[model samples]
Target: MNLHKILIFSSCLFLLPYLNIVLFIEETTSNFYEKYMSMLLVCNFIFSVLFWHNPISKSIIHKIDGFFAKLSVVTVFLYVAFIKDVDPYNENIFFLLYLFFISFARLSNKHSRKEWCSNSHIFYHFLMHLSGIFGGIVAFL
Candidate 1:
């Protein structure tokens, strides 16, 4: 079985809804959260393009994707802390960090990092991406 195909197919499936929402849906809004959410979802498109362009360990594209994907959690959850009232998301950052640590733990086997585009990495990555996007939508909306 070609893990690359699994990576590509699953990644696209994971992002297909986002791709439509971000691209085909015409909208005008002043909501900062919406704009920020859109921006975070855009990272998925970037990763898709980069992976398709060069699905190699030598490429640093995933790092870019990882950085933004991971960063979005922090940004999305930030407004909660600023809310004048008691905020449920006060613990969101810590929760996300905990989840990330769980995912990072998958790197236990030394070969995991060596593969770069390995299936486990791809799976864990999309899980993080899914968690961030879904969590943002649930919490912010």
Candidate 2:
């Protein structure tokens, strides 16, 4: 990934845990799962930043980042769907939309690289951040 994209992606990852903590401070204190979930989110943010900045091959970095990103998403989905007793309909729909946006961003990124389209990659990077924001909103609501 480009350095700019990497920086923006890592920054977004860093914000996710903070956003959750701020938005659900009360629930985080009262709910055991939420507490642990917050910890996981923090760890995810830390490790993502570390891995992205580590001295590794770009391909390896991308693989590791992608794995952790997907894992974090799955963990959040499980927490929201099974652990919390919140309304499923809205949350599930939002989560699905988040997934859709992420998938499209990934696709766009791949196509941009293959076609040597820098603008497309930047657009997809923006979409990726937008998806993360939507996911944060879903968590809060």
Candidate 3:
């Protein structure tokens, strides 16, 4: 597909591990998800500022990313401001890597460096999910 589609599609792929983590964390406790949701907000804030003037990024993904990023920040604020306790490690770190992977993957595509990083991104993406299986075991046990 074209660049924009690739970015969005890649983003969707990048989101799978995150979604799984959300589900897995949900099973454990809402506080865990809230903590991670906070981290994602910080990540998104950095992403938006860094990519703000980037002409290469897809507008759709950029906008959606901004929305989610802001949502994450607000969610975390609300969680912390109201929630009694927040545990950082409840959600797997691999999920954070999942966000990094997707963002880098999209950025690489925007820069037309896909030939260099696409395969590696895909490889890491696959490995991250596989690691999630292991993480699930460790997390629940």
Candidate 4:
């Protein structure tokens, strides 16, 4: 499939649970704050995926989204670190480093081919998957 189709498909896949979460929140809670926060999160998730289609790295929107991703990663680490007690405080540091690398990869897209090593795709996808899982768990709990 083409990149645009892949992006659209991925967005729809991510949106299912996202919408369910929002609907559940709306049904369970009356507070506008929580409701709006959940909506905002849904929007963020959609926009994050949309960033892949940005026209240029130098675009303001691209930089803003990059900053936003960094913010989300930090927020997830902090939530797990101090609030949820799901992981050690030191884990936040490691997460921050990982976030840095992700941002670097997204922003720079520069790295030696030698750096891929033997399990480059495996390791990269694994970490990406791990972060999403960690973030989801932290967000839910």
lDDT of each: 0.53, 0.61, 0.44, 0.47
lDDT computed for candidate 3: 0.44
Candidate 1 lDDT over residue span 1-141, tens digit each: 355454455445535435545665556622565556566656755685567456665358857765665565566556444532324563565456446644644552243576665777656655554554445444433
Candidate 3 is scored at a TM of 0.31
Per-model tally of clashing residue pairs: 0, 0, 0, 0
| lDDT ranking, high to low | 2, 1, 4, 3
Model 4 lDDT per residue over 29-84, tens place: 43443344345456556665675454244567657655755555565455545554
- The per-residue C-alpha lDDT of model 1 at residue 44 equals 59
Could you tell me the lDDT of residue 81 within candidate 2? 67
- Candidate 1 vs candidate 3: the TM-score winner is 1
Q: Give the clashing pairs for model 4.
A: none
What residue runs in model 2 are displaced by over 4 Å at the alpha carbon? 1-10, 13-17, 22-24, 27-30, 47-60, 112-117
Maximum-lDDT candidate: 2
Pick by lDDT: 1 or 2, better one:
2
Give the runs in model 1 whose Cα sits over 4 Å from its true position: 9-30, 81-111
TM-score per candidate, chains pooled: 0.56, 0.63, 0.31, 0.49
lDDT of 3 by residue, 1-141 (tens): 222323333333434334545566565454475447535634553454344334244576466666765465345335433553424654435345445545654554454455532445444533433343333222332
Say which candidate scores most in TM-score: 2
